[model samples]
Target: MPELYERIAERFGELILNCPPDRWEDPSPCPGWTAWDVVAHVISNHRRAIAGLDGSGYSAPGRGEDLPRAWDAASEAIKAALRDPVKARTLLGEEFGSMPFEEFVRRMACADTLIHGWDLARATGQDEGLDSEAVAVATEILLPEDRDIRMPQAFGAKVPSAADADARTRLLNFLGRQV
Candidate 1:
């Protein structure tokens, strides 16, 4: 079975693949970002993680490559990195502050993908439900570090949600997402 991060990436990839070509330019939940920008951001996140492994930064989509293909290339690279024992053990820098690559990828990358996956789905009028296990894991991992994640450059301020809201809703609300 695929690990949570891989599964989350795969789920996100499915959304990118199924998206109608015309919808690529549609504005997504992220203010001022298009559906294509969402994919590029996810790929950029992957490149950041990859940089920890080998100092390579974000590579924009090639002239012949669409967003989906670019996403596929990024997804495969990150998965391969995590699968390699040596690469998974590499240390992250900067915002991650020297955490092992696997831990950062599992918690941070996985959560990023999970939330952005919902953004894409919502923007494109697809199913917005997220994986229950991924949601639970994200809640468990992020809720404790609430203050750290609440900065304007990151998830920013929380949006209100009913106390009775489900796990996913609460996570979304906490991550500065209205839904």
Candidate 2:
């Protein structure tokens, strides 16, 4: 079975490789974030999570509330950090002490990569689809948490109870995003 973490990383790499720098500045689905801003946030997340994987409480540098520059710098930093052992880890975990590094990485990366991909696609008018494993992993990770119902920002949308529904849509809905 393909590891969801690796799949998520591959998707991130694909986005970086395929998305143009000009597209980075475009607006995203996120209410206030541009495509570049989302990229920055994703990069920062990878960097920080990798730090935690290394057993260091990695902290993301302030984006300074400046969207464009912050996004650009964060993208650059994430790419750069992947080359360092201290910043890159094959394994990952959460800072909130919620779950194992592997499990946390699966859910976090899936949510970030898939949702942000949607944001980027919406902004650039590109086709955005998540990997099947990512969708499945995200759905499985979310179903029992009840966090989706408790936290409006994280998970507020209603997930369909249909058994034959698409996993990606289910994950998105579970995360409170309208598909």
Please provide TM-scores, in order, for all candidate models, with all chains considered together.
Answer: 0.89, 0.66
Query: What is the TM-score of candidate 1?
Result: 0.89
Superposed model 1: Cα runs more than 4 Å off: 60-65
Whole-structure CA lDDT of model 1: 0.82
Candidate 2 per-residue lDDT, tens place, 1-179, comes to 22455555656556655677577677776656777677666766765655665565544445455444444554454444454544344444334355544444555666676677666766766667888867776666567876544553344546464677677766666665566
lDDT of 1 by residue, 57-105 (tens): 6565543567777788788888898889888888878767788888888
lDDT of 1 at 11: 88
Positional deviation of residue 126's Cα in model 1 after best superposition, in angstroms? 0.7
Off-target runs (Cα >4 Å) in candidate 2 are 55-94, 148-156, 159-165
Query: Candidate 1: worst 10 consecutive residues by lDDT?
Result: 56-65
Worst 10 residues of 2 by lDDT: 87-96
